[model samples]
Target: MEILLWIIIIGLFITSFVALFFPVLPSVFAIWGGFIIYHFFLNSGELTTFFWISMVTLTAVLLLADVFTGSLAVKQFGGSKLGGRVAAISVIIGAFVYPPFGILALPFIAVIIVEYWQQEDFLSALRAAIGTLIGFLSGRLAEGIIQLIMIGWFFLIIWS
Candidate 1:
């Protein structure tokens, strides 16, 4: 039973990673949900209430991060709102097509095309595309760091 729950957590972790590559999905909270399951079922023997509260808190933080990370990055990096919207749509499309890399490429391509169409300036379009690329990359990096921390917490709970 514990092993089964652990396996589910592992699966969620993998899904979260896959989500990170896709633009529309939020990876951090998904993995955080997996953590909630793991802590509540597998390794949550000693402090059930504490684990639940912690899980909720973590979920809230990750949710906020997911919501604002990209938009904030876009503006900070000089991408226009329209270009960001295009990139976001591309992300959803990418998810249905292929995995990982396919998803990652969507925003980059979408921003480039749409920015060029809207601005008619090759250099400006390129800058917008670059901004989206950097934002996505940085967001993914943050997701990865969260995953690592969750992994560490998971191991600590199960092994210790």
Candidate 2:
């Protein structure tokens, strides 16, 4: 039973990493699931209040990062608000359309199309598309790093 539970927890942690690429998966929730399993099933009293608080804080940061990074990038590149929203929606759609490549290409294409349609300026649309790509990549990097930190903290707590 203990080994099985450990496997499940580890699987959830791995899934969290996978979620970095596929936005459909709830990355933070997967990590929290592992922690929650450890707390409820393996050792109820193992996780301290500090652990929970820190995790919650980090989760909030991740959420904020997700919401702002891409939109801010679009705005910085002179994209309209609609461009930012299109980029965000395309990212989710891209994940399922063709996987990793789709994740990269779809947002760029969508942002370009929408921006061009709205502004009727090819160069400006291209710039917004580039910004969308940069923002998506940046957000992914940030998420990956933060998730690593969260997992590392979990291990530190458990193994120490």
Candidate 3:
């Protein structure tokens, strides 16, 4: 029974990793939810202090990365503070509306819209929007790598 529960937890972790790219899923929280199940429900023995600390720390880091990268992307693209704010809101809206592509598209669209509104120039808006896209993609790549590492570490802990 514990093994079955563990498998389910692991599955959730995997799903969370994939869902990290989408704004709607809150990937760090999803992974943490799996741990919550294991800790509160299936865990038969106390986890090591090191294990607990690692898990919590990693989750917090991922959450911070999510917020920081997005805002940084806006700043990197030469966006105004208002643009960053709109990008944040667009991320929330993008998560629920179209998904996957929408996750990537909406932020770009939002940045471009705001940039154009502020700059009143198509070329400048396009440039900043492209920058936002590049930064966003970089962040996504980093998140994917981190999620892979986290999942790999989890597997090591479970199986070893």
The numbered model that scores best in lDDT is 2
lDDT of 3: 0.74
**RMSD to native for every prediction?**
2.9, 0.8, 2.1
- Angstrom error of the Cα, residue 7, model 1: value is 2.6
lDDT of 1 at 129: 79
lDDT tens digits, residues 95-159, model 1? Answer: 77776666567788788788778778887888787777776677667767766776566566557
Go through the candidates in order and give the clash count of each.
Answer: 0, 0, 0
**Deviation of model 3 at 70, angstroms:** 1.8
- What's the TM-score of every candidate structure? 0.77, 0.97, 0.85
Index of the highest-TM-score prediction: 2
Model 2 segments beyond 4 Å from truth? Answer: none
Give the candidates in order of lDDT, highest first: 2, 3, 1
lDDT of each: 0.70, 0.92, 0.74
lDDT measured at residue 156 in model 2 versus the true structure, 0 to 100: 93
List candidate 3 segments past 4 Å from native.
Answer: none
Using TM-score, rank the candidates from best to worst.
2, 3, 1
